[model samples]
Target: MKVNNSNLDFDSNATDSESERAAVAPVVCLENIHKQFGSLEVLKGIDLKASAGEVISLIGSSGSGKSTLLRCANLLEVPQDGEIIFEGEPIIWSGSGFSRKPSDNDQVRKLRTNLSMVFQQFNLWAHLTILENVIEAPVTVLGRDPLQSAAFGLELLEKVGIGDKSDAYPSQLSGGQQQRAAIARALAMEPRAILFDEPTSALDPELEAEVVRVIKSLADEGRTMIIVTHDMKLAREVANQSIFLHQGLIEEQGDPEELFGNPKSERLQQFLSATASV
Candidate 1:
């Protein structure tokens, strides 16, 4: 039904309802975040929040630190400064600045499991079948029963529209298929939120549409997601809060319609203008 549709349609009054839901508490919150690699600063004094069922899109040019911000939220890359709070718990940290890291291994692991990341590249195991790839982490890391995990993994694969390919190796699938498999893997975690880093960038236009369709279905189901994307249209369509990042800082942010249609910052306006032509 809804999942099979190519076009995404949202209720006209969803904004009001979503706002009410978001007022409870953010699932993930970042305050005054700062990240740097060597001497090159990536994210500078950034603040972000993702409440349950709210979709946030990070959009900017290359080197704008959108992906870096996502990584910090997922703890794939620890920020040199800032508080990373998940579901009301602040990440325990040790040291300061460049030397800072998460102090509690258990906390990091717990948070990581609750925030699943789907990367730009498929990142699937070539040797494992699609179903195995989907169930591997759940069965091993989460200690789920193998038979039950396999059944749920198959359901997730079907949800992503690749049930027929469950026994296929990643090498046998197209870029879009592999990415869908990755999405299934992320879903298998039953995470509180999903972090997407340029999820459609690796596929060609036709194949990209396939992945986009699945993402739209997820958005329709009100999945909490933070997406770093170059696809302006997808950002506008799926994101409730659209943030425009420039040179490692937030240039502007607001409702996607207002931010995209009536950008306040000149930088954001210019960025939209440039991306519109591509």
Candidate 2:
């Protein structure tokens, strides 16, 4: 398959006939978002959106708020200001500032149902086996059928190249296997949009490539995803839209080819230069 991110048109998979066409909306949208950690402002009046089947990548230096933005998008870190909308519905909130959160906890939970996040550290449950980890959320949070979920979970494990280790505990597997298991867990949710926060950061070169391969396959399948990563080459290969954040704000963003090929912002140029070998 030919992948060209020259214009961030991550819609190659949207090639449906007119008869199959339907009204489409962004899978997720963040509007004028702001976040702070006791006076350390992170995200500052930021707006981001990912449409169905689109792949987006966020890249920058450390503390540029790339991870923070991903956290805020999924409500892992509640933004003090701004709107988080999932599939066009704004998350219900009332209080202001640090106190801001979903007015109804249930609403927030429901919203999370449509968004899946893959963390930097493979946050797998040490107590559970690989298959169990994948099905736990669907069976518990979503109340899906455990028996059916198990069968499907096995399929996902196989897809990620760890099917044979379905019964193995995370602590028993290699770091690469564990991260792939985490990805299987996220896929089990079958979320509309998947948020990846440095999915391969914790792995060695070989292990990291394994996870990156899995991620690239997902992108080819038209899964909508927003990824925060330092892997510039992988970002360019897999993402259509690319964003560069600097000092709590977006410094530059556009098609990955344009942004990575000919960076316009001085900060982005410096950051890219710094990580060129990687």
Candidate 3:
């Protein structure tokens, strides 16, 4: 499978009007995902799929489990009863419910390496310079050469419009710059897809626009990403498919235009109305 080559003559802003990866084999699949916290059920039988280069947006209210589902996809959060299929291969499971985890720890690590995450909080190491933060994972986990990773890190930073800030520490930059640097770090791994947990939630409107521009650029390049976002406009513009989750269950899902234009569920109708006001 020929994905967006991170090393080629990659133009972050270049739009690919060719066919989307909707027909490409799924890079990540969440089957019957169920999660709970003591007595509270966060996700119930949630199913999702992201094909190569396809961007899917997860939308819901504060407690609707969108973030939790995204975390489960990357196994940052464990789902008691669900199957995570990465590149079509299911992770080995050992137990049921709360005790559930991948039987093979090594496999879990390898699977996670491909499903990189960009958090609501930039989560950059405050002590490390932007370039160091970006190259850490590639050099440490992937065993990529530091020199090569540094070069790629600089390219990714430039792609996110923060190349000059590579030597700057997180605290020295604005919130938007930090988030863009975080995005550059996620891109450093050259993963199959990215799981964005509300990439713009932490920023003000002005700062949010900076990150959104980079996200739109990535979408145009056919980079597979599953984004958990509250920005309805962003969902409409960047996501090919939008999923509306209601109290841990998928209430509605389809093309963003169709789902937003003509919502089928009363719950979704109310949610849309509420978010529209925000």
Candidate 4:
């Protein structure tokens, strides 16, 4: 749990020695994160760390604050209390309690670019082609050349097994295809880590398998990721670390194998049984 300051800044293009040192530090760290909507508390004093090439899965029942925790990681939803650190740099805040918000827009923007989020709903632009959806942010936000972005976008789409449907819009694709396109779009950012919020929940079992395969492939590639999912099978299969939340706090967490097969917490055992019956 000790974070090394020497590994604070990570550069993919760094020398081998630097990369080795950087691998020890977390790409993202959340400390004592607390969030509440009006009077309803969602997260309470949560702490999480994701190092390079680490896949962490958050599994719990609905209202356990899984989605809110993901949003807070990229500053999509600011926590009223706690620290959000990216590459060891703490986020600057402007106010206290309910009015608290990130103080610097530029810093938030920089961090967000490295933390790509894939929503459960596949929030793609219906008017744009699949390829366009993948390249838009890289071109507009990062100022990359449109031509090169399109080329890379196509490569990403191909990687996601949707090269033939690059010209199709979100409305024209099946839910599985659309989700794959969304995954490709997330890859287009070349993010340090990808955050998946129930990426497979929107699809039927057959369609869900498609996304699961892609996610498992990413894990095999050593991609740093945090997944919030209801599918215990996917969590057990792909995650290096698995965490179970109950009433806004981590009830139990550890290696996926032990967590799933020999869960010590009664709540997690109950949860696994219920999901199994579903």
- Per-residue lDDT of model 2, residues 58-126, tens digit only: 998999999999998889899999999888788999889988877877878877877888988899999
Looking at model 4, which ten-residue stretch has the lowest summed lDDT? Answer: 1-10
Candidate with the greatest TM-score versus the true structure: 2
lDDT of each: 0.89, 0.87, 0.87, 0.89
Quick one: how many clashes does candidate 1 have?
A: 0
Tens digits of lDDT, candidate 1, 224-266: 8999999998999888888899999999887888889999999
Where is model 3 more than 4 Å wrong at Cα? 1-24
Best by lDDT: 4
Model 1 bad stretches (over 4 Å): 1-24
lDDT of 1: 0.89
Give the higher-TM-score candidate: 3 or 4: 4
**Would you estimate the TM-scores of all the predictions?**
0.92, 0.93, 0.91, 0.92
Over all chains combined, what TM-score does candidate 4 have?
0.92
What is candidate 3's lDDT per residue for 1-278, written digit by digit as tens? 12333211112223363234333447898989999999999999988877777788889899999999999998888999978999878888888878887889888888888988999989999999999999999999999999989999999999899999999999999999999999999999899998899999999999999999999999988889999999999987898788999999999987777888999999999999998987
